[model samples]
Target: MKDIARVSLPGLHKSSGGFKSARQVLIIDGRGHLLGRLAAIVAKQVLLGRKVVVVRCEGINISGNFYRNKLKYLAFLRKRMNTNPSRGPYHFRAPSRIFWRTVRGMLPHKTKRGQAALERLKVFDGIPPPYDKRKRMVVPAALKIVRLKPTRKFAFLGRLAHEVGWKYQAVTATLEEKRKEKAKIHYNKKKIIVKLRKQAEKNVESKISKYTDVLKQYGILV
Candidate 1:
């Protein structure tokens, strides 16, 4: 009994498992990335115990016929419990939630490890405050430009989500307003800085002129 107790299982403890092996936080920029490819990479990273944050989910691309993709989404919406429609295979319309669901499908979400991995994953529609300042990692292999040929048609995740009642336009409008406000603040600050600089220069010039006048009064000028 003592020996068995001392023999610890590999993943039985949090400090000794896959979580300990990979504790790094990975911030992924989802812009221009192929949805499936990005989801696959993120799923693997999450399973390896790395905390993954995917930003700009709206910019992620899906490589396929745009119309076909819309049709697919419409078909998916048709799936629901017959008895009570709400009982329900819920479908997410937001790009971030759509990406989250994609990654979740790749993980064994019913199990404890999978749930733990899911817990470490975060998907954001846009780059939020602190994360906006952080350096984001990009997967070259998962980029749409690299994976899809120029001739192939592709649709943005944001566009698709918007079509499916995601209110993406409203969200983007809000973000635009915030950006404009920030720009206005920055411009005001610059104006203040320039005004202060001119004031200081005038002060220096006035002081120099006063000193020159004092020298003239003393008959010290050439």
Candidate 2:
């Protein structure tokens, strides 16, 4: 070969002092996306050393008859050896956690490198603040609306999460609390803005009043 093309990563580089690695922080919106496809993409991105944050995990879709898929998951959760309960695989009931487990299955999690890659992944049931306003990318290939066939029924992870023992009420309460906090913050800022504007207007009126008083000496009466 005449030459090897030099390939450099965006946030990963080697230095004389230490091994430096920096990767892209990718934020993905999981709403209305297919679980397997989304998980595969997330796994690939994390393995590339990029940080992946998946939001709205509860809204992710799984293709199949709703009840069938539900029962299938329930059966899988029951897998355990009587003698080695501690050694059996653990499953998560929360929608966010279930989504995380799906992603984990796509990775070679038994190895050290796979575990490290998994550390870069984050999944949330809903859009959390700080990420709520950020630009979130959607996986086109995994979108249910775009790819759904009218004939095949579908199921949402949100419903499955509830059936699997996730506390839906608690999630709702927390989300409501967060919304209230954000609303309060916004109201406070608006109040401060209105106060400042009124103060400025008063200052201008006072200056005009002073100017009018000066005009009194010139025989200009209001």
Candidate 3:
């Protein structure tokens, strides 16, 4: 039952010698071209109410000319009025926040319920070993290797996963679409169970309290 509420952790736990729950932290390592893919995976987990932590973000793959890409990004930002119009020599570009924030938009967090789950995400540039340096971990190969473009839909979906702190796991050698859909179903099922359990607990508590109060009034100490 505790597993239902599990959130992802970025690295190994020292004293516990494992995760606080079976659920773990998501970690990705890549550069440039692969960065978007990795981010997509992370964002997926975040949407499922998991806590996520990213590592070695700068090393992720990038497929294009770095300078040219930066220029294009800056131009886009300029057109969007991302900076003060009066300011000169100022430009906006990709940073971890930009990358992660983009993924957040993919989520349905505008809803009150989603906003409640949005508090679990965390992003970092390098391994944040909880116990020791040796304890640092990486995402399973099954979680990585998903390739999504920068299209609007992809960006939206990827950001939703990011906000939830999902990890990339491409190690199973399964088709990308299948693995993602499976993960999504698993996440949704777990969420439903957790919600139902909370409601059940509340109902049980209410019954018990009501009975106990009645007994007390009748001089029964149960």
Backbone clashes for every candidate come to 0, 1, 41
| lDDT by residue (tens digit), candidate 3, 64-148 | 4455555545455556333656555333122345556645666677887556445656554333444213223444322223343
> Which runs in model 1 stand beyond 4 Å of their true positions?
1-16, 19-23, 176-222
Using all chains and alpha carbons, the TM-scores for the candidates as numbered come to 0.71, 0.68, 0.43
lDDT string for model 2 (101-171, tens) is 99999999999989998998999877777787666787777788878887878998888878878887366
Who wins the lDDT comparison? 1
Q: Considering lDDT, which of the candidate structures 2 and 3 is the better prediction for this target?
A: 2
Full-model lDDT, candidate 2: 0.79
Q: What is the per-residue lDDT of model 1 for residues 110-199, given as tens digits with 9 covering 90 to 100?
A: 999999999999999877877765667778778888888999999988989999999865777588578558767978998999999999
Best to worst by lDDT, what's the order?
Answer: 1, 2, 3
User: Residue 27's C-alpha lDDT in candidate 3?
Assistant: 40
Candidates by TM-score, descending order: 1, 2, 3
Please list all clashing residue pairs in model 1, or write none if there are none: none
Candidate lDDT scores, in order, read: 0.82, 0.79, 0.47
Candidate 1, lDDT over the whole model = 0.82
